[model samples]
Structure formats: C-alpha cells, structure tokens
Target: MSDFSGIWIPLITPFADGAVDHAALRALVRRYADAGVAGLVALGTTGEPATLDAAEQDAVLATILDAAQADANAADAADATDAQRRPLPVLVGVSGNHTASMLARIEQLNSLPIAGVLIAAPYYTRPAQAGIVAHFSALADASAHPVVLYDIPQRTGVRLELDTLLTLAAHPRIQAIKDCAGSLDTTLALIRDGRLQVLAGNDLEVFSTVCAGGSGAIAASAHWRPERFVALYRALTEGKLDEGRRIFHALVPQIQLAFAEPNPAPMKALLAATGWVRNELRLPMTRASAALTERLAALGETLPR
Candidate 1:
C-alpha cells in the first residue's frame, strides 16, 4: 500500500489578478517542501477544486509537481538531512457523484507521477451502502495509483459507515482514509483494524490522531507554520508525547480560528500576511471577513517562526 502517513498539506490554490497565480503557487510548494511535509494534496477541498475549471485545475497541479521537482534537485545539492528535499509525494483529489465520469477522471490521472489519489464518497445523492461500495470499488480498480478514501460527512452529506469502510479496506487498491467523519468510535476502530492508513482530515485532530496510533493528517492550518506542524508529527512519531502535546496545545486556538470562516478564507488571509499570495478566492467564496482577519492576526502570534 502507498504510505499516506505524516503531515500532508492540502494546499490552497493561490490566486492573483483573476487567475491562478503559478508563481505564488510554485513558491508555496517549495516552501512546504523545504519544511519537509510528508506530501501535498493538490486540488483538495482547501484548494477550491469546485471553483476551478478543468484547464485551471490542470495548470495548478502542473505548477505544484514542477516545484516539487525543483525542490528535490536543490536538496540533493545541499545534502539536506530531511526528506523534504527529495521529490515530495503529491496526491490529487478526485471526487464526483457520477460513477462513469469519476472513473474516467481516475483513469486520466493514472499517467501522472502522483503517489495516489484522495477520493471521497459520492456526494448529495446519498447512495446506499452497497452502491457506495460499488462506486469506490470500480474507481479503485480503474485507478493506476493507490486510493485514499475521504469520509467527510458534513460536506458530503453522507457517511461511509464503519462496515462499508472495513469492506473497502480489504481492497488492494484502496489503501488509506482521510477521517473527517467526526466519530471518534470510527476513527479508533479503523486504527485498531490496522488495515487502511488513517489520516486525520481536520487540523485540530492531528496530534490526537497521531497519538491514538493512527497516521498523521491532511491538514490545511499547517499551511502557515508548517515546520512546527512537522515538528509535532516528529515528536509524536518518536514517542515524545509531552513535547508533542505542548506544541499541539499551543496551536489549538489558531487551528480553530482558521476554519471559523469556511476554510481557506482565514487560512489564505494568514498566508497573505506572509506576502506569499493575495487573500483572494473565486466567486461564491469570498476572503475572510475584516473582523476575522484581525482576530486571526492576534492568534497567529502563537505560531512558531
């Protein structure tokens, strides 16, 4: 199975001048690479995949892969100690309600050098458990890369029940899961099963997940103070519980605030403060409110330099 452990950032697509900002996008990828993130998930929910058209989405992904390659080369030259310098593994997020369309999309991504894909349950339609099983099974069978199932019910409106998840875990192609089901029972059960790698989809759950014998996280809050996030992962992985808990405690407040304004808004606002990219989101998605921004700045002081 493909390893989906450690801290993975679901990058927010940087926009400027009413188009995808490839420059800022590449720089952001390089920054994460330097911080030694386990990998990155391109076009994930945080990346605003729904708002981007096919061409724009393709361009955004190309930029990230390109940056990963460049960062790998620099790391080799500098003899960097961390794995961040290596060609970072990249995961593409692919989801849809249409089975045929979703299968085609997975097939299309088979050619990329991605480690695997992060897929979600069919949304809105709320298909039966058997239908859901058939849906993901077919997609995983068609995909060349490993599959990481996403179980985020709040956004998808349907949950992949524990039985369904265990069944899917038996599939060779279906490897890991992004656990946003908000059910600690499911989280701990899946971890106990020890089949699929369980990655916490929520930022606030990263530390607890790691300490709970599950894998790391696919976090959006780590976009700002990424290295500290990495350190926490290391501390937990190395069994430094006290150290890990301390870092996690300090980061709890900011992590909560980042999602206070509907993801990627407050996150982008904080990133913009770093001058990495403008705090802009596409239509239907606005920037974090002025009040939220001010509150965020005050909380951001707790982040590591």
Candidate 2:
C-alpha cells in the first residue's frame, strides 16, 4: 500500500486562454517533486477539476505522471530498475453524488498508474450516515487502488460522523482520510485508534494534526512554500516541536492569504507573479484581487525559499 503520510500538494490546475495548460501543469509537477512533497493529488478541489472536461482531466493526469516519472529517472542511477526508482505518487480526486458513476470511474482508474483516489461523501443529496457508509463501502470495494476518504463537510454538506468514519475505517482498502471535517476530537480519535492514517485536509490544521500523531496533510496552501510545509511535517514527526512551531508560524500568514479568497485564486495570483502559471480561472471563479495578490507576493518573498 502507498503511504499517504507526509505533506501532499493538492495541485492547482493551471489554465491559459481558458484552457488547460499542459506546460504549466508539468512545470508544477516537477517543481513540487523536486521540493520533496510526499505526493501529489491531481483534480482535487484545489485543482479546479469541475471546470475541466473529461479529456482535459485525463491529459492533466497524464502530464503529471509523465513529468514525475521523468524527474525520478533524472535523479536515479542510469541502471536503476523501476522498483529502485521512486516515482512520486499521485492521487486523483473522484467525487460525486452517484455511486454507479463513481464506481465506473474507479474501474477506469484501475488501469492508471496513480497511487489512489481521494473521494468525498455524496454531495447535494446529503445522504444519511447509513447511505454515506454504503456509498463509500461500495466505492472502496470497487477501487483497485487504496481509498482516501475526504471529509470536508463545508463542501459535502454532511459530516462523516465519528461512527460513520470508524465504520468505514474497518475496510481494508479505505486506508486514510483527508480530514477537513473540522473536528479535532474525531481527528484525535482516529490518530489514537490507528486504523486509518489521518491527513489534515485544511492547510491551517497541518501542524496540529501531525503533532497529534496524525499522518501529514493534503494541503492546498503547501503549493506556495511546499518545502516549508515538508519541513514542518518533518520537524513535528522527528520530535522537534519548537522547530515545527517556527515553520508553521511562518507559514500561517501565507496559509491565511491563500484562503483569504476562495481557493486557487490567491494561490494562482501568487504563482502568476512568479511566472509559474497564468493567473486565470474558469467561469464562477475569478483571480484574486490585486491587493491580495500584491500582499501574497510580498509575503512570499519573506518566506524561506
């Protein structure tokens, strides 16, 4: 099983002229892989996957996988076998209200080289806990890769209750969770129980979660100062609380700014300033305000590179 621990970047899908920019996407994959993130989560909420058509999504995943493999090859010995080379793991996000569609999607992913799928509870329908359990159970059974349960109630409109979470954790394939449920008690409980590896989904909570013995994070904010985020996780896991706290404190300002506006806007704005990607988003989502962008740029300069 792939270890879903350490810091993972839920990538932002870069767009140019209102279309997916393969060049920018591949650049991001190489940058993060070099910076040492634990893995990458393509098409996560941060990636603006909903705006992308099916073909574009497939291309984006292919680009990420190809770029990561290329990076692995470049770093390893010439004679290194595939098993000896560490290809960066990438998790593709799959979420929806329909079970059969999700199952079919997972079935399709069975042939891909991705690490796993990140799934959330059914949205819009607001299924009851029983239904949520049934939904995830069926998906887990169908998935050839390990499952990372995404529990962001704000988006899903329903909480994965403690019982529901514990129930789902019993499944062999449901190995971890992206915990944005905003429940520290539940986070602690899962960490203590040791059934599922708990990865903090909210960027701000990464420190506390890792400190509390949770795994790491699937942080959107980490896209900015990814090395710092990785360092913070390393410090906390290695019993260096003071060092971890320092790194987290430095990153809090950026994290706050990243989410100051809804999602990838502030992040894209910053990346644009740095020429990493164009600051563009699809309809219903726009770029961050100029003021916020400037602030992110200035603060980004102050952060350790």
Candidate 3:
C-alpha cells in the first residue's frame, strides 16, 4: 500500500455538456501530479460520487489511474538520468448501506490497481457502535486492498466513537482513518494510541492534524492551493512548526470559503474560474452562489493553481 501520508486531493468529478468531461478530468489529474500531491482520491464526497452512476464512477477511476501512470512515465523519461518518480496512487471511495453489497464492492475493486479504499461508516441507519464495528470489520476482512476508515459523524449521523475506532484499528487491513469525528481529544487520543494512521478528513484541520502527530489529509480545500497544502504537510513532517503555521494561517480564509456553501460547488467554481474545468454539476447538486463565484474567481488570481 502507498504510504497514507502527506496531502491528497479528493478530486471533483468535472462535468461538461451534461456528460463526464474525460479531457478535463485527465487535465485535473495531471495538474495534481505536477503539483506533487501524495495521491489522488476518486469518487470521494468531494467528487460528488452520490450523483454519479456506476459506469461513470468506474470511468472516472480508470481515467485517474491512467493519467497518473502516464504522468509518472513522462516524468521518468524527462529525468531518465536520475531515479524515477513513483506514480501517485489512487484511492477509491466505497460507500453502501448493505454489508453484503459493500463486501461485494470491495471484492470487485480488488481487481483494480488502486492503492486503497476510503469508506465512511454506514449512513442514515444510525447503527450502534457495535454494528459500525462489525460493518467495518466485515469489509476489512473481505477487502484485498487497505482500508481507510472515514468517521465524519455529521454525514453518517453516528460517531465511530474512540473506543470503537481503537477496536477497529486492530484489523491488519484497516490501516488508517479519515478523522472527521470533530473531537480534538478523539483526534489526539487516536494519534497517541499509535494504532491507525489518522488522516484529517476535515480540510480546516489538515495542518493541526499533521502537527498533532497524525498522518496527513484527504482534503477537499486542497482542490485549490494544492502546492501550498503539500508544502504545509512537508513543513510539519519535518518539524518546522513556524513554517507550517505560516502556511496554515495563510490558507484559513480559502478553507472557510471553500466550505461556506455546499462542498465541491465552491471548489469547482474556483477551478472553473481558473479554466481547469466547467462549473457544472449533477442534479440535486448545484453550482456555487454567483456572489461567491465572483469572489472565488478573485481568489483564484492569488493562488498558484
């Protein structure tokens, strides 16, 4: 498995003319590859995975793997006189309510070249912590790839309590977590517990998470200012607290606005302003406020995207 460390972009699925924009999607992958993110996440919450059909999801993952491979190959050719750069691994998000189907999904994904799977606790059902434990353990047991547990209680409506998390950590296949449970004590406890590699799923906490001895982040705000995010992670990992704080402080405003409205819309708006992708999204998911869109465009001028 690829190291679940450093910055990763939960890529937005770019849409255009009412269809998946493969050209723009590939461009986005190459953009992040050049920026040197640790990896790319596909079909994540930020990617609007809920709105895409199975076929669309499959295509998106394939495009990301292909682009990452091509980008790595090109970099090697360019620097053939030196050691080769490893292609960024792709992490695919898998979510479902039914355990059997979830396990089946993991089984299907085992055939792919992905590095791991990012899965949130079962949503809407509000299962007990024991049920949550069983759900994750069952998936982990069935999965051939590593599992990164996502604990965003707001969306899933039930916290994967710290005790439950500690228990799940014992599974060899459950290697890490996307820590969105919204508790500093929980975050710190998980870090100190020294079991699972805890990644900040909340964009605002990326720097704090890394500084607190957690792994890195699977950040949505990273869709913009990606290089700065990478720099911040590097700064923290190397114990340059002042440099890390400086980068985090500078990025706070963008992080706040990126999530001010619903996700990805504001993120996609900023990307569209930069001519990276169309500002379109699927039904039930709309674009950002025209007011915010203007601001994002202005903000885009300041970022290195």
Candidate 4:
C-alpha cells in the first residue's frame, strides 16, 4: 500500500485563450514544488480535469509529470547528495462516473511516473453502498499503482459508507482515503479501524481529523494558503494543537470564500487576482462574480504567509 501521508495540493488548471496553457502550467508546478508541498495532484477536482477532453487530460498529465521530474532533477543536482533530495510524488486524479472507463484510464496512465490514483466515489447516479464498494474494488484491482479513495459526497451524490470503506481497505492496492465525508464520525471510524490512512478532504476539518489520527489533508484551499496548511499539519504532528488552531482560525475566511462558488472557479479567480493563473474556466463552470472576486481578493491580501 502507498503511504500517502502528507499535505498535497490539488493544483489548479491554468488556461490562456481557452486552451490548456502548458507554459503557465509548468511554471505553476515549479512554483508549488519550490513552495515545499509534499506532492502534486494533477487533474483533480481543483484542476478542472473533467472539463477537459481526453486528449487534453493526457497532455496535462504528461506535462505535469515531466515538469515535476525536471524539478526533482534540478533539486537533486543542487543538493549534490541523495540524502538531501527527495523526489516529490505526483498523484493523478482520474475519477469519473463509470468504473470501466476509470479502469481504462488507470491502465493508460500506468506508463507515467505517477505515484498513485485518486479515485472519487462514483458521482451522480447515487449508487447503492454495495455498488460503491464494487466500483472501488474493481478500480483497485485493475490499477497498477496504489489507489486513494476519494469520498466527497457533497459533489458526488454517492457516499462511500464506513462499512464499505472497511471492506475496501482489505484490498492491498487500496491504500488510503480522501475523507470528505463531512462528519467526524466517519473520520474517527477510519482512524480507529487501523488500516486506511485518512486524509481530510475538507480544509476546515484537517486539524481535527489529524488529531483524530488522520495522516494529513488533500485540500483545495492549499492552492492559495499552502504554507498555512502545511504549518497546521506540522503543528498537529508536533503536538501543538494551540498553535495549529490559531492558524486554522485565521484561514477560515479565505477557505470559506474559496468554496463560496463551485470549485476551481472561486480558486481560479483568487489566483488570477493575485496574478497566479488567468481566471478562466471551461464551459458550465464560470468565473466567480464581481462581488465574490472582490471579496476573495481582499481575503487573499490578509492571508498569513
């Protein structure tokens, strides 16, 4: 099983002139690596991978992996010692509604230097608990790399129940879970179960989840407040709850605003306002409104670095 135990950013997709901006994407990847994120999750919900076509998804994944590999090489050269260098893992999110399609994508991605797959529970259709387990079990068995189950029921109508998750955890390939179950009960259950490593998919619950014995988080808010999130994880791991809470409270406003609208849109707008990425989303996912843009901009300015 893959030990996915750290703070990973579900990176934002960059666009220029209604296309995947490769240059901007490479720059962003390098920037995040420099910022000290534990890893990079490409084509995640924050990356708007669903909006992109199949060819676009392949292009984005190849570009991200290449860039990350190049950055690791450079850092290794700088250190001049293997002990001082660690290659940052690249996790590709290939989640969708269909199990067969997802399995195919995982097979296609097998050649890449990707560390694992982040599979969200089947979205829409709201499958039964048994269906959810079957879906993930198939993917886990098919995937050559480790599988991290994503349970963001708020977006995906189907929720991977505790019992189903326990069953899935028995599969050696199914390593961890991105627990966005939005409840402390499920989070605690996973921790107490003693097998699946829980990652807080919700930014607000990261500290408490870690306190409850979670591994870490795969937060969208980390796109803007990467350092703060990293600090919270560090503090919690260091047994400094007071210090973690102080930073967590200060970041609540930004986190709330980032998710105010549909994903990436709010995060894209905030990044654009700060000159990170262009505030452009594909059809169906529009940019944040003027009022929200202003609010996010103001909040970005006050966020603790």
Candidate 5:
C-alpha cells in the first residue's frame, strides 16, 4: 500500500574491526535522512546483508527503525517552520538462495517497523519464471507490509521476465520493483504499460528510465552524492530535463567509481575517506585497493551540493 515511487538509497553497512559499528550505522542513517532521501533500505546488497548473521541483522534493523521513528517525531514537531523535515521510510532487504529460507526470513522481519520488504529473485537456484511468480505471490500474501520485487539478473543469475513481472504486478500486496535488468526494452515495456512503479536499480540508467516514464531509483552511488541524485529526481519531477541532465553528467564519474570495484567495498572506502564510516568490511569482502580508495576520495571532493 506504500507508494514507493522515488529515490531510495540501499544503505551500506559500516564496519570497524570486523564488527557492526552501531554508532556509525546510526549516524549514517541519520545522514541519509537529512540528505532528503525518499527512503532508506537497510541490509540490502550495499549493506552487505549477506555478510551479517541473524542476530546482527535483527540488531541493525532495530537501530535503524528506532532512529527513523525518532526522526519522524522530530519532523512532526518541526512541521510549522520547515516543510523539508520529514522522516524517510525504512525498507529492509530480505533475499536468499532458497525460497523456504526466504519465507522464514520474511516471517521473522514481520515484527519490524519497516515500511516494506525488498525481495530479490531467488539466486543460484535459478528457478523458472513460473516458480519465481509463485514464490513472490506467496511472499506478498504472507508479508504484513508491502513487497518490492528486486530483479537484478546480473547478480541474481535469473531474470524476472516481462510477462511474469506483469502477472506479479496484479497482486495487491506487490507494490513496486527495484529493476536492475539493465535493458531499455524491458524498462520501456514496464513504463509503457504504466502498471508497476519501476525504480532504476542501476545508477547509470536512472536518467533514461525517468525520461522513459519510470518512477525513480534505488541507487548505490546515492549514498555519496545524495544531493545530486535528489536534485536529478526533483528536476525530472519539475519537468526540467536539461537541468537534470547536467546534474547526471556531473555525477557520472562518481557513479563509475562506486562500482569500479565490487559493491560496498568501493562504497565503504568512499564513505571512510569522507569520515562517514570506518573503512572496513567483513571477511570474503576486503577493503578496496589503495589506488581505488584515493580515486574515490578525489571524486567525493568534486561532488556538488
């Protein structure tokens, strides 16, 4: 029932000494909220949710929800003076390789104060399109909150096809999609139909997708250049395409470095360089190279407000 039709940042997990840095994590969430993000997605790919254990996931979600509620209360108090102050919605990502495990995870998350769930298409198992539809349909019915489909074929190894996506859209509990299929044709098909709100999961495709009548993005790079991404979305909404393109071009380099290495490694390094979070990651995902870190730092310096 939530209208997820704007920019949401898939927040990165902050680490210090191979542990979840709760203080730093809270600060980062506050920063995203203050930066005017439409929503915050905790424990997504960028959050390195896969690296976290069950306890850590629960703790992180609690911290994020607590801070979000506080912020919402603050915004309500400040409504008389600053219309800009509003609490951003919190979205938790629940993705796994097994359908049953994912269902269990969704059940566990039902108690959280999250606005909705972002469920990635089952990875590695590569279930058929029909299986994918059935799995999501069951999840939508089970979830207490709305469900946002995550279709990043490059990472998940299985694409949620157009027909199946259309079918899934009709389900009342299914709200929107984090579309990372990286295909203009597929994006256009969804937009032309005007059924589901299409969020560009890939940063580079955001401008085109918005121009093509899609909703907005859930950008990884938005963690760093939050204002620029916000301005792009606002410009598009205001029908100022030329201004939006200028901001988009200015951000191309930063977006490139955000993914220059594998995901949160590069993003974490960038955040660390800016003193936002400590430059650390759990095992199996090490810090970025010295050169990449330096480049990200330089790119961070060039970003506009």
Candidate 6:
C-alpha cells in the first residue's frame, strides 16, 4: 500500500477574472511544497472541482503536477543530499454517483502517476451498505492506483458503517481512508484494527486522530500555515505530545475561521489578502464575506512566521 501519512494539503483552486488561474495555482503548489507538506490532493472539494468543467479540471491538474515536478527539481538541485527534496506524492480526487461513469474516470486516472484516488460514497442516492461496498469494490478493482475512502456523512448523507469499512479494508486496492464520519468510536475502531491507514479528513480532528494512533490528515485549513501543520504532525509522531498540543492549540483559531464559512472561501480570502491568489469563486460559491476575511487575516497574522 502507498504511504498516505503526514499533513497533506487539499489545495484550493485559485481563480482570476472567472477563469482557472494556472499561474496562481502553480505558485500555490510551490508554496505548499516548500512548506514541507507530505503530499497534495488536486481537484478535491476544496479545489472547487464541481464548478470547473472537464477541460478546466484537466488543466488545473496538469498545472499542479507540472509545478510539483519543477519544485522537486529545484529542491534537489539546491540540496542533493536531502532525502526530503524528492518529489512530493500527488493524489487526484475522483468522485461521482454513477458507477459506470465513475469507473471510466478511475480508468483514466489509472495511467497517471498520482499516489492514489480519494473517493467518497455515492452522494444523494444513499445506497444500501451492500450497494456501497459493491460500488467501492468495483471502482477499486477497476482502478490501478490505490483507493483512499472518504467517509464524510454530512456531505454524502450516508454513513459508512464500521462493518462496511472493515469489509473494504480487506480489498487489496483499498489502502487508506480519509475519516470525516464524525464518529470517534468508528475512528478509534479503525485505528485499532490497523488494516487500513486512517487519515483524518477533518481539520480540527487532525490532532486527536494522530494522537490516537491514526495516521495524519488531509486538512484544507493547512493551506494557510502548512509548515505549522507539518510541524504539529512531526511533533505528534515523534512523541513530542506537549509540543504538538501547543501547536494545535495555537492553530485552532485559524482552523475555525478557515471553515467558518464554506471551505476555500475563507481560505481563498486569506490567500488573496496575502497576494497568493485572487479572491474569486465561481457563482453558487461566492467569495468569503468581508467580515470573515477580516477575521481570517487577523488570525493569520497571529501564526508564527
């Protein structure tokens, strides 16, 4: 199974003049790469994939991959002996409610060099447990890349039962889980079982999840202060509990404000204020409010430099 641990950032797709801002997106990828993030997830929910058409999605992903490669080469040139200078693994988020369509998407991804695919339960349909299992199993079977299950019931309107998860864990292709089910019992259970790598999908739960023997997180909030997130992950994994706790406490405010509104809005706002990307989101997903942006800016200033 691929090592899907540490603080991975689900990048927000930057926009300018109502188009995908490839330049800004590449810069954002380089920023996170330099911050020592474990990996990157392109076209995830945080990236506003829903708002982008197929061509735009493909372009955005290509830009991210290209930028990451460039960043890796630059780092290797600067420090050939540094093991961490190697290219960061990149994962593509593929989701859908249709089985056949989703299969085709997964098949297309099979040829890519991504670390894995992050898939969620079929939304809206809320299929039965058996159906859900079959859905993921077939998708995994079709996918050449490893699968990372996303278990967020709030958005999917269906919970992946513990038994269902255990069953999926048995599959060779299904290797890890992005746990956002909001059930501590299930989270701990998966951690205890130790079959699949459990990555905390919730930003706030990153601390608890790592402390409880789970792997790391795929936090959207880490987009702002990724180094601190990486530091916190290292602290926890290295038995520096006190240091990890302190960093998490300091980060709680920023994390809360990042998600104070729908994801990527406040994130985009802060990034915009800092001149990283334009503060624009496609219609139906507006920019973060002035008030929230102000709060986020203030909170961002408080983070360590």
Q: Report model 6's TM-score to 2 decimal places.
A: 0.97
TM-scores for the candidates: 0.97, 0.96, 0.97, 0.94, 0.95, 0.97
lDDT score for residue 189 of model 2? 92
Candidate RMSDs in order: 1.3, 2.1, 1.5, 2.0, 1.7, 1.3
lDDT for predicted candidate 3 compared with the true structure: 0.89
Model 2, range 1-305, lDDT digits (tens) per residue? 98999999999999998889999999888888878888999999999988888899889889988987887777557875442257889999998899999998999899998899999999989989999999999999999899999998999899899999999999999999999988989999999999999999988999889989999999998888788998899999999999999999988888999999999899998888778999899978988998998898887676654
Q: How does each model score on lDDT? A: 0.90, 0.90, 0.89, 0.84, 0.85, 0.90
lDDT of 1 at 295: 85
- Model 4 residue runs over 4 Å out of place are 76-84, 303-305
Summarize candidate 4's per-residue lDDT along 139-247 as a digit string, tens digits.
Answer: 8888889988898888898788888989999999888889888878888988999788899988888878888889998988888868777888889899998998898
Q: Is candidate 3 or candidate 4 better by lDDT?
A: 3
* Model 6 whole-model lDDT (C-alpha atoms): 0.90
**Model 1, residue pairs in steric clash:** none
In terms of lDDT, the poorest run of 10 residues in model 1 is: 296-305
lDDT of 5 by residue, 1-305 (tens): 67787789988878788788989988877777777778889889988887899999988888888776667667656342231255568889998877778789889888866789999888888999999999999888889999989999998899999999999989988888898998788889988887788999999998998888889999998988687798899999889989998989988888888899999899888888788889988878888999999898887687543
Clashes of each: 0, 0, 0, 0, 0, 0
Clashes of 4: 0
User: Where does candidate 1 stray beyond 4 Å?
Assistant: 79-81, 300-305
TM-score of 3: 0.97
Candidate 3 Cα errors over 4 Å, as ranges: 80-84
lDDT of 4: 0.84
Who is ahead in lDDT, 1 or 5? 1
Give the higher-lDDT candidate: 2 or 5: 2
